[model samples]
Target chain A: MATVNWRTINIDALDPDSPANFDLSTLTATVAPVSTADVQSLAGQIRQLLRGGDNEGALQGALENPPYGADERGKDVHLATVIEILQSIRQSDMSPMLGRIYKSPGGTEALDVLMKYIYKGMSQTNAASTTRNITPQATGFSQIHSRGGGEGGGQAMSVLLSWHEKVVEIAGPGCIVRVMTDRRTV
Target chain B: MGPPEVHHLFHHPIADHSFSADRQTLAVARENNVDLYQRAGGKFQLKDELTGHDKTVTGVDIAPNTGKIVTCSQDRNAYVWEPSPQGWKPTLVLLRINRAATCVRWAPSETKFAVGSGARLIPVCYFEEEDNWWVSKHLKKPIRSTITTVAWHPNSVLLAAGSTDGHARVFSSFVKGVDSRPEPSAWGERLPFNTVCGEFLNNTAGWVHSVAFSPSGNALAFAAHDSSLTVVYPSAPEQPPRAVISISTQLLPFKSLVWSSESEIIAAGFDCEAYRLQGSEQSWQLAGSLESKGRPGVQDHREESALNMFKQMDLKGKVTDDTKLKTVHQNTISTIRVFEAGAGTVRKISTSGVDGRVVIWTL
Candidate 1:
């Protein structure tokens, strides 16, 4: 047998950070560390709501306390961990846990409630926390490494946006595309 | 053009598939076993399963004339299944390689077949009357890495192999006493066993994912990992090729392709939809996607209500609910084969994908 030198080329290392094309600069804004104390207390309540399996209640708490502040790393960590847990709950099930909720009565209303919470929660992180933007950007798989970069407001929005993207991706493009092309509402 | 017929046979990824001559039996490589489905009431139902390999079965092909099935697996083995009254009988071919057999295909004559392997070799196998067994002759000289795909020439003597080493080569597997002397062609004139007839590499050093010979066997086309398809046309035996047309597309790399005609090639891959490429020996370009641009008539739109909004929000944490893709296949399309063919042209094509769907498209 003739000897041939073989080499393995990793497709990722050739072009790293292919998924960082999303412009997050406009999405991020600095927040003054004014409401740090209020957000921390609210996080405790959200934790209790999450433990009670009340996703809607937890979403409501997040919306009310919306954790926006500079130097509020403690609250940011708490909220991010909560979102991570919710995301896991949505993922671990065979059908999306949220999809089941959507099929249930008032599921859309609950989703809208959660959506409202997510909108506020996205703006809950500190603005000056751009230094904590150490999360590796997604390459292909929608695996978020850290809560997104934010003073406090952007991380929640990022999580919400990413969640929607993941759901759309998993559900096939039809779910959202059909919604976009529908003339019934008009 | 109604929607293509779809057979969602299994939940696992179908690595490869083949249809029997009568179009009744379908054999698919699913995990470690090859599952055969027979068409009944316009739908394929499970008929039998061939289980022998210890690892994942990578490729399967049915010889239409001989009514034989050949399968290879990651377990470094290939089995030829001959149909009998007692169902299909499996006979292990003496491949004598120590690496995973990636792909296998019976030649046009059904007398021989080629197995591409991770051992960096293409074994051209033929039956031996004296030994009463199938034995292979390894074309092991110039290949540098694992062979990903193989295609046999229409004459059944020349074999084309694509490898991870970023090269696609044409080797003469003209086994003595088995293959008669082929007429002079664009690939070569004088051919012998293991003769390297032609070798070509992609400009970007991309690993070739698939290789195909045009219906006439005068042209060769290969799809590479760089999302480009290169078509090669040779001039004469020792002369340089007349044209090497490389069309780099913006789409993902194609995993499989087949000649719709001498002038058209249909390819599909990670995009989950087939695309038509039209060309001559001088030039080639992507025509369009084989799928309809969009589904305009099938309206399943739910009335927009506060309830729907909340449901979307709760389930997907969004106000918009768009989960269904317009494409028939929801994932990567891995293989495309000619379903119905005429001389140097195909009328219908069948595609199987990672989503466990087998869709048949008409030309």
Candidate 2:
């Protein structure tokens, strides 16, 4: 056994009941502005996206597997981005109905769940492609600027959602999100 | 630094060689591949090639007594291969780890060994039941940083890992029969490094390239990207790790540091030169710097030897307290060994470095 670097972190000394120790808090996330009800609503909308009758087949194909390290920074970035896109779509006047969808709390909840599945699908797709290669890939805006200082900040989720324009399409008065898939490319 | 007669030999073309645990077998993992060689008469000669890994095998470590060789690659896996009746063949492949594995080491008892990955620290265990190697243990949480070097304490229960992130991570070694295994806690610690990594993702010290423990396991020495060697009190759980002392200046990065078999003298190495540390205060005066034209790593070629640097020399440092360092050779030093292995002697110094050669020097 190697001499433990216990001096640096007496892991045993850390009380599970205590607040997060400042000693080991690296990259702690900041508080989010979304209300608890707003969060639940976004989760609900994403849940509807997974209903057995509504594009459940495509959703099934996408949710076939779970993602690893996808939760590394939590789902905040993903959800924020989803909200940003939904908001932008409503502002364009093409999806007045979509703007109404976000006016309530349930839509935000659905957005969170939708964002999770989308991120999960993204990770799975990337993993299958690089199983034999040497390094991990970056699939979103946050990751692109993950290196370097402060190039991306504030509503990171919003920034990433706006960045991937080709993957999404907003249509008509019925506020709807169209997630395009390219299974053939994989 | 005491006065000792040191000489440097010249080498040619490509240099830098590594030896097996028994000190008899030396393998050169060179520029595109690894070349296997054996000791014939007094020099090393081409033996056979051990090929299975895709990229150059940058690091190798042999388990004591077993003669088993483990090689790490840029291909994201550490392959445990052994030299058999036919030649080198694959035994087991430990996968899913840091893409770049810079170093590997085995415990003194040979039952366990460790590998250092680019962004994480992975310790693989040899399981006889499946006869395969698995990512048996590691830091509780993924370190998410690059690991550069690893070494085992002589007693064989403690293993230390150094990374480019500037902090050193240590793990406890487990024995086969021992009931009480000294496992590292769920989390690994982040010690300070000589320089600061300017990268935006993390805030730690500059890159720590190398680390070495004292003969008695009382102290640990480390080499960093900055031209310096840091000595620290390495074992504890209740206290914070603090640097006891550091040998640094603006000249060059000290690549390696080791203790004499007796635990009294310290040998330090810069990539091209080897020096010594003497006195109770551990004043790091220059000992021998390599002048060797021979393969540089030909210096420090013993298991029990705690000499640092490749086989080369310059001049000796004049200091008191039985801690003066004398010049050993003139070529670049790639490694250093205490000729007495663990005999606890302070007389013999062996080194190897850039020359890919090994040489023994006596004080």
Candidate 3:
């Protein structure tokens, strides 16, 4: 699986005052080894290097880099968890306020963010929370993680994930594990 | 107390037929003319003829909750209908899909829609958002070798797509257009485990002519070319397929199927036989068969003699290809649908085809 650089886009990039501007960012974890402390660290530093459109490195340093390792077959188990979380969230009726979602007038930014998360990797913990929430966003069973990217036309939209499912935990929002195939067959 | 048994509801057949959300109106497919019908006075009356399809019409659908009518065709286009004071009018011509479409279906909420085709060059399109308007996003590649059919979850953002290779795939009807800010109206299908909320279901005995999901979106029934009906549970991939029953009696195959709202009742059309699965008594005999309204049994002796007379024509040494396997019937079922009238119980179903005639039955 490809490792996602959690620090490529600054979490601070969003407006500090508006929760809408809050960035789901972390420290210079992209190039470091992950430990419980690395996972919990509040300060993040970005080591800038071109991987591909904000898609590179890991936020937390871990000997394992991407804790999920370089395995592809594990995607289905991860996907199954996604379904479970979605079902749980869908059954309930809670809608958490997402203070900050990339706002493209259309839906690409939100789309891209979701893709980036999928690409980055989904945290089993974060995923479980989203899945368990009974809010409209979690349970409606028909959500478009969309934004027009402020306007429309052509804008890049992607979802990355931090597979925090019991089976595997991925990283960031726009990062995808090269080996994992959640986009298909899952 | 059988005051009057409503035999069945008859639906008009053009090519593609879709039901409205509240199950009120139905739209029939026509190459250049799409017909909208009001269910009450008659099974299907010409409410209006929608134009814009430049070539043969391939598919038609009505939104589940709003009764918005959407149509797709060889013209490489799709149109969405909205309610107007005058009547249901074509409100949006949104965007044109590049591939010639074979089928179209709406998400349960009418918030999203899908279009599929046989052409591999073009991936299926599932449109959810347009900037200041609605725009379409697409699956990057063909889910199957040759896309043939697509159906959406009646109440959720899930999709069931069929391809010529006899495979059907279910996928997360992921909403499109995600920006940095959090979403307000997202209600997409959720996954239980690592598995996609959707899965690939049964392949048909032969090319599938049509597929229909129950009103509740609980079960899916598809009829194949061999006149066999395959009913499956789309959500439970863990369970084995429940049934793959054959609707014997037709040699050519079935063209369409429509399911009733309250029961497992399914009405299907074969060459000459219109078979339906009625009554949910929880028994195998729950299935009831309906013979063709006008099947010409074996031609009478005189007509047979006349046909034989024509067969008598011969160039003494003339070559002959395959002869008739069975006597050809004049009527072939081309389309089928089930809908509701104003009164909840007065449900209607109908069929039409080669005869170019329409028949309506009420339940």
Candidate 4:
């Protein structure tokens, strides 16, 4: 007699839970397409806010209206500004900033947008690190230099992870689910 | 005002269900068959079964005046069943699509019907007198994804469809020979086949699960996966809508909804209970749940004796029996249909769920 492993069975194939059954594209809003020029101007404004030592304003500006219709390049530019603002804020001020944002109107949606950016940044950092690991023929001196760069990337990742933990705590788990299912690009 | 009538038919999910005009016969899509139940002794008893498709039947609708039954299935086929002296006869419809049909609804006039499919198009099927068979004309353009549900206007010329693309669109299904010229309304004047009348998106871009036209067919309401119900009223052709009111709810997403009147909408889904929403075109809000708070059989306190606990753990390894829900329907309500109506107001409504229970609620 043969024993069956129910855990290993593909339940989605038997049920109607397959990804092919539901198209993710249908979950996106049909907003007017955003061009690269609009994103460039928004990025310049956020950079100015950061230069004036207004990190909270810069972060809120970056999150107020994500370019849902922008191309990859436009999204990357906006994401870089958001990362800069996140890095500038001290660890002690994280909870207070999040508390204020969560209590404000439309705060839940803004936090959801921030969650999307955090996940995107983490994935990109992981991809870059994996690509560097694929080429193992580096000399000892180059390896040392790469290790230093890897430590910087690791620090950035930890900061993002901490922010993720705080956002989930403030917004509840629904924010994460909303970010995953939301089709609006950030 | 009274306890709802519940009939637990079987332990299988009912994808859709419909009642005859006389309210004596009930048709439900169960698994791969359409089961017809006759009202006997104040209860529904299985009287006949219509089985043809090899896959699960997704939708079933019985014509009120014509006494014809139309069913669609996941096998990419549809059949029209007619009663004769010998038995019910089935006629195959030429849908001409390779994907599974999701839903089917007969027009108010009973002259035609619209079928939504996974192929991302709606096929409006009508009988061809010359060919002596049912044929379909596809509504193909501008639809980006699979259509989940479709509704027909009161005039039988306009059709509303909710699609996975997060859009609830109203289209002109005016077949030249089948439909007469409709009067100019807020939708448009020159209504032709495949004319796009209006398109509205959900607030959060969630998949539109259900779409319905009001009793007068003047307003459109849709429930999306974001747990929000949106109502759209068109002001005129090629202009902005008069009002687009959205009511967000804390309940789970609604799978089906029906208008009780011009001012009230009843919706239900995974929450396992029905809700009442009321408003005009200006604004809308969640009225409350339809389930009475003081219904019988709701055990507020359970005796927690040590012997009882030990016996329960000895029998099932669980402390409490939390299987039953407080609501009438134990699982997700899959479909809701108007059971009885008079003077443009729904007097009674019927709901069916995955728990295989069909419940009738008196409004």
C-alpha RMSD values across all candidates:
17.4, 22.2, 23.7, 8.4
- CAPRI accuracy category, model 4: incorrect
Query: Which candidate has the top score in lDDT?
Result: 4
The all-Cα superposition gives candidate 2 an RMSD in Å to the true structure of: 22.2
Model 2, residue A150: displacement in angstroms? 35
Candidate 4 lDDT over residue span B1-363, tens digit each:
888999999999999999999999999999999999999987999999998999999999999999999999999999999999977899999999879999999999899999999988999999999999999999987787889999998989999999988889999999988999998889888988999999998557777899999988889999988677899999999888899987655467889999999999999998888999999988898898889886777765576899999999999998888878888999999899998899989988999999999999988
Q: How do the residues B1-363 of candidate 2 rate in per-residue lDDT, one tens digit apiece? A: 333333222243122345675666766556545666676775666777667668656676655577777777776667666767876776655545646766676666667667777645565455555544444555423243577777766655666667654566555544355213433331123322111111111111446667776666656666665455566653354345433555433234555556764234444444445555543334443444434333343433324322422221213342222331223434456555554453565565666665544566555
Best by DockQ: 4
At residue B39, give the lDDT of candidate 2: 67
Chain B TM for prediction 3: 0.65
Ranking according to TM-score, highest score first:
4, 1, 2, 3
Per-residue error for B350 in candidate 2, Å, reads: 4.3
In the range A16-46, model 3's lDDT, one tens digit per residue, is 4322352312200122233433322311211
The TM-scores of all predictions, comma-separated, are 0.67, 0.50, 0.47, 0.79
lDDT ranking, high to low: 4, 1, 2, 3
| Model 4 lDDT at residue B161 | 98
Cα deviation of B272 in candidate 4 (Å)? 2.9
What is the total number of backbone clashes in candidate 2?
106
Clashes of each: 34, 106, 145, 0
Say which prediction, candidate 1 or candidate 2, comes out ahead on lDDT. Answer: 1
- Report lDDT (CA) for all predictions: 0.77, 0.48, 0.45, 0.88
lDDT of 2 by residue, A32-68 (tens): 3434454445445555554433433222222222121
